[model samples]
Target: MALSLKLRQGLVSFFLLLLLLPSSFVAIEQAFYTQLLTNAEQKLEVHLYAILSELSMREDKIELTNNALAPDFYRPDSGISAYINDEQRLLWQSDSSLNQQFELPNVELIPGQHLFHLVSQQQNFWVLSIALLFDAGEQTFPLTIHIVQAEQMLLLPHQSFKRTLLQWFIGIGIGLLALSLLAYYWTTAPLTRLDQEIRKLEQGKQEQLNLSYPSELKVIKEDLNLLLANQNRQKQRYRNHLSDLAHALKTPIAVLNTSALSQQPELKEQLDRITAMIEHQLKRASSSGQDIWKKELPVRPLLDKLTGALHKIYRDKACPISIDCPEHIQFRGDETDLMEILGNLLDNACKACQHQVKLTVTDKPFCLIVEDDGPGIAEHKRQQLFNRGTRLDTYKEGHGVGLSIVAELVSSYSATITISDSPLGGARFTLQFPLEQ
Candidate 1:
């Protein structure tokens, strides 16, 4: 079935070696054995020619038919057997151990000149034959000689050669396998370290990832660092913009409040109108600041801090503020952004309620619910309550900016806010945020 990386690589290399190596080795070995056999036959031919020459000298005759040279003339410790003949008869023969095992071919007695032949008998013995010509004073005599040798002796060295080649193949294959494993580990180590660094970056454990890898991965490391730097710069710019906007709105708001305290009847009404307009603008500026800063605040802590501050501020009214929020439940918006949202909604609820306010934080899908026991808004006017400066009670101290601010903060954070009748016979506000952002 399925092969791992190391085994797959090893098997591919081994098969590739098999494809190219064995045929070449076999071709070379066969050529070497053929050459050895040929050289041995040539040496035997030379010895037979020398014996013919000696026989001609003694008899002073050109014809070898009546010459007395023995057929065993070239016998030696090398186990060579010899035979001599003319075109007519079997003249002489050698008595070697191989003579009884094979029938030597009559290649030399075939009535030809310079003929040679090699034959095998019972697949075990090799016979070599050659035709000869001798000159005695311008008269030539034709003679034929035959030699036979055992096939086992000629084939001995070839078997040993094959075994030696097998051993060499095994040794080389093992050496290559060891080298491949070492190379694989050396090459993959740096890549493994880079993987670990990337995981740490994903978990937000590190501000930047650094890795020392080979030349090919250097560009990847540089690109990641550059991306992190750009994100940090964007966050800083958003924070600076919110601070500048808040600073610009504070002085105008103070001047309008001072003018509202003046005593001339006509001026007082104009000053009051100016103060109301200034307060509406100030609430818009405050909500805008929270929108910009909300990206840094988590959800649970912001709700806790808001409920605590509202309870303290409304203590003289004897209204109870109940909070139900889970610990460590974080949100994507900034702290000031959530503060502005919850603070305005709770302040309005406290002012409307005669005795009790309830705030519930459910962790299931990140929802905030606020309810109060007071005179609730009429059903027909609930839709207009979010409009700027739309106060139902003219005697209330605020310029009706609280609900409008709540609406704007919720919109900026991409959160949903809804108004409904409370179970306590007053208004209920529910805000919901997506957990995954």
Candidate 2:
């Protein structure tokens, strides 16, 4: 169960990280690229203004001198070009590659700051055009100076920034995986130990769990310890009750046994019957009381002792009793309780058979089957067998409390008792217990 909980937590964490990491990385990368583009655009606009100012001062020369100060003036990789024109006629071009025809409306040509399109070999360039107007007497000359730069130069830094961002993302992902493993171990270790401690308690080891934990878990540990202490107290109280009940019943049973053996035959017979009934009731009470908190008991030795006692009690009767049980089979029940159940069952089976009786006990899944070779009970009569004092024959010299006691004991433990035909041509009683791991 602890492993299942840890696995569930890890899966949830992994998916959460998967969703958050990408979003965080993209937001950071986009913010960085936006700032880089803004800076690049501002620098480009300043450089274009400076170049346009230089050209405006040289507009008087009909063919501008090639020595106009800027270096690499006509290089394709320079990322800058310029053109000069006046009144629908090109007077001078700074670079022939920059002289391509542009479709611009007349409104876009202003005397100060203006933006216009410049076509260069099928690619469009952004041109900042400024017209210089000089008035000598009554004539005004409109000299348009265009500064052109390719847009690709503005996007170069963004690509480089994205490449660096991808590298950082890979590194962070690996680190997070390593951190997740470390966190899983650190968090789950105490829980694993607690689970093992609980299993030990279930197996009757009865040791206190000692864990070094954080404040959040300290409360849980205290609660578990309190629960364990309460359970131990309850078990001890049950044991004390059984001992007291047994001691209380002992003297009365002794008096009854003594009175049953007195000299008057008729009175002795009546007292003997009452004494047997009292003894049966006492034994049933004692067994039931102890079983209130009984644990698992080894089966073979108890069965051997019980069958041996039965064999000796019926030794004078001319009968053969067979016993078959595995030497190592164990059952979850009280020893005294099972002894009573088996004693009553076998005693009744022996009386019903004339010359042969057989007893067998076998362990099965969640149950035990006890069978005897005797006259099997009829279907209709079996139901009545569980009622107190309901004997099938009045001539039988015993109180009919045996099967009833068995029924009561079985019911107390929430076990089932079923009567069926045995393979030995006799009765079978299958007692089904709750499954234990």
Candidate 1 C-alpha lDDT tens digits along 238-321: 556656755776676557657745566776666666666765555455443332222323466666677778778887898988
> Could you tell me how far off, in angstroms, the CA of residue 200 lies in candidate 2 after the best superposition?
2.0
TM-scores of all predicted structures: 0.45, 0.53
Q: What clash pairs does model 1 have?
A: 294-333, 294-334, 295-334, 296-334, 297-333, 297-334, 297-335, 299-331
Over 4 Å off, model 2: 1-16, 56-73, 77-156, 211-215, 250-437
Which stretch of 10 consecutive residues in model 1 shows the poorest summed lDDT? 288-297
Task: Please report, in order, the local distance difference test score of every candidate based on alpha carbons.
Answer: 0.66, 0.67
Per residue, candidate 2 scores C-alpha lDDT tens digits across 273-385 of 66666666655655543332234456778877877887787888756667676776666656677887777877877766666676666665445566666677898998899
Question: Model 2, poorest ten-residue lDDT window?
Answer: 287-296
Considering every candidate listed, which one attains the maximal TM-score? Answer: 2
